[model samples]
Target: MTESVQQLVRYTRIQEIVGDVIRLRASGVALGDIAEVENTDGEVSIARVIGLDRNIVSLQVFTGGKGLSTDATVRFLGRPLDVVYSPNILGRIFCGSGEPIDGGPLLTTDRHVPVGGPTVNPVMRVMPSRMIETRVPMIDLFNSLVESQKIPIFSVAGEPHNELLARIGFQADADVLVFGGMGLIFDDYHFFRKSFEEHGVFGRTIMFVNQASDPLVERLLIPDMALAVAERFAVEENKRVLVLLSDMTAYADAMKEIGVAQERIPAVRGYMGDLYTQLAQRYEKACDFKGAGSVTILTVTTMPGDDVTHPVPDNTGYITEGQFYLHGGVIDPFGSLSRLKQHVIGKETREDHSQVMNTMIRFYSEAVESERKQAMAFELSPFDKKLLKYSKLFRDRFMNIRVSLGVDEALDLCWKTLAECFEPKDLLMKQHLIDKYFPDIAEKETG
Candidate 1:
């Protein structure tokens, strides 16, 4: 016997066709309702109900309106988009529409959960208390990545942000990794999967991919799909899930395109006025469920031409906790920040983590000034010469971007660098820390 498919009731009135958006006089249709548009050639495509004004509705065709005439048949599916949620979802890769494209069996026999719903209730959320060690010195040591934190890697085109995300997915201590690749090239998508599998983390990894050639509408769905699975993992399975969303600027571009198709008025930089709300709807999904595991989000937002004030990064900076600025092929220590790092830095990490972080950054900042003086050929003092040496050592040891060290290793390296650049009295750490952590300081004092 064959499985029966429910046939939806169809509508024939097509009022207007502008680009991929179709407008029609309709009733009993709700926003976000799934619709099917059939062209004159009997080819059908799936669309979403994006705009519903009184009785008239506007639908965005996912596959785009290519061959559809103004008289295309419209069928309201009476539902929004949903994904299959189960333990079987792990070790699987799906397209933006939640279809398994990895040559695997079709997903069945599980719950169908809606995507792009409201974020978790703030009352149910607890203060994030755990640290998610990415094992990257720029993050784990200096700026910690706390659980339930929503931060972005701010980079431009041609940067190694994808490499950074892959490293985190491979090394982060989270129980499950949910990755959403929006507008990625085929190579980047393949790299993520292959790297995860090679690093032996693919079993707990679920990927929702929207390639550059895929429909723009799909890009908007990738984040929601990934976050839905992360939520299920965190709340039900009690798993600490980390969601990695890359190239959110592409998602924003897709939203802008759809907004233009809907004839909506554009806001700042030609983006929709509600860009912040739209971004918050997805990013606010990062949460720590009470007594359960948390869902931490780390997304990549590529700035256009490295402009931070661009509308996408501008709105994103407001929504996300903080940003990791990826410039000069590295995570710039001066530019990147984790606002929630203070919550878990010393509490969850070592006894000297907070002090080491402060001392290293302060010294590195002074080193930068010393280097500028040297570049200007200014006569340098003895302290300025020491600052120059410390800065160069800091860049090579910590800021090299490829310098992958654990938090403990990074802290140890900080002391070694300080010992190389300064004497016992020159290091301004607490006396107890100096007595305990800085053996070289005591050795210098004895000598």
Candidate 2:
């Protein structure tokens, strides 16, 4: 005799009681299916049966216990939540649920996969020594975004962090670009798709988007799905993948919500104590797998109220190698740092890259101090005067976000700018480098 099968059951008046919980036994037919519970009001929520005690199963609902009722009907979908993944995901807009909000095709590929899994193991990782040149002066010359380097753009809302990320995707020398947009506004998402398409780079780019209007659960899956597919491309296909995630604050918020649903005790600012570990799991995925392609991550984490001390950014700063702080409509040189820059600063780039970058920034910083002195009517020294002059030239030539230059050209322009503002001796760079790279500015200055 065959074992009897459990029949499906429905509850009609789930909202009649308060503080009531319903338990169901997995019919043993669909173990991994995300069980759906619907209330009499036609409201639906997703829950996972984490504990099964002989006949009764314990489920954790994503939305928590506020509106659910004992009378709610439960149905199992026979599969864990999976995202539709394919090459056609390029140049299209999607909501948090992986649904095409831009009215595109359903992405009917057989390549769907589950998101939010454990990160790559340590034994499978490789040291990150490659450079991903974006040709953006602020990145290539100054901060030097390294391959497999996990970095964040610390910016407040209304800044051009999205635009910067889009520019990098368009220009960066990588085989594939995977972009994950969490809690992005519709306009911003459209802008990214349009920018890539117009630049003719959309074919090599794949976007996983979670908009502000989508359900919160979808936001949690965006990063995982992106990193999972990226890992496959890198390790299996030997493709250099660059993953761009915008507004990680949204991802943090999703984690916080899940923590609340699980009734876990909150740590700083109502965030789960595992916040650091969770972030590390994703960021550590930036690796150069041995004998294969690499995955480099550049994410945007918007600081709420411009507070770097906020829990989200504070934890992020610790986990990431360095940060690009965006402020006042520009990448703030004083606030940015790239810890992995040494790997490529003087190796993959021009010999003068390190010196030129440091000297220009040092002078630019002094120029800022000189401007402050001028504001207070203090007498300016000769060096201060030179600093003020060089600062203006520096801002125009290199600091502008719209400015573009190859690594070599940028270094040459640095020499030109320094020659125009100060004497060769005053540049304080090695005499040998000055002799080799300094343009005819020395003769022009002396004459």
In the range 319-415, model 2's lDDT, one tens digit per residue, is 9999999898788899999999999888888888888888988888889999999999999999999899888888887777778788888888888
Q: Summarize candidate 1's per-residue lDDT along 1-447 as a digit string, tens digits.
A: 222223344476688988888899887777877888888888988888889889889988888877679877887776788888998988999998788989998878778898878888889899988899888888888778999999999999999999999999899998999999999899999999999999999999999999998888888889989998899899999999999999889999999999998889999988999999999998999999997889999999999988999999998999988999989987898899899998998788889998888988888888888888889999999999888888888878877666778888888878778877886578787888876777565654453
Model 1 TM: 0.94
lDDT of each: 0.87, 0.79
Best by lDDT: 1
Task: Estimate the TM-score of every prediction.
Answer: 0.94, 0.86
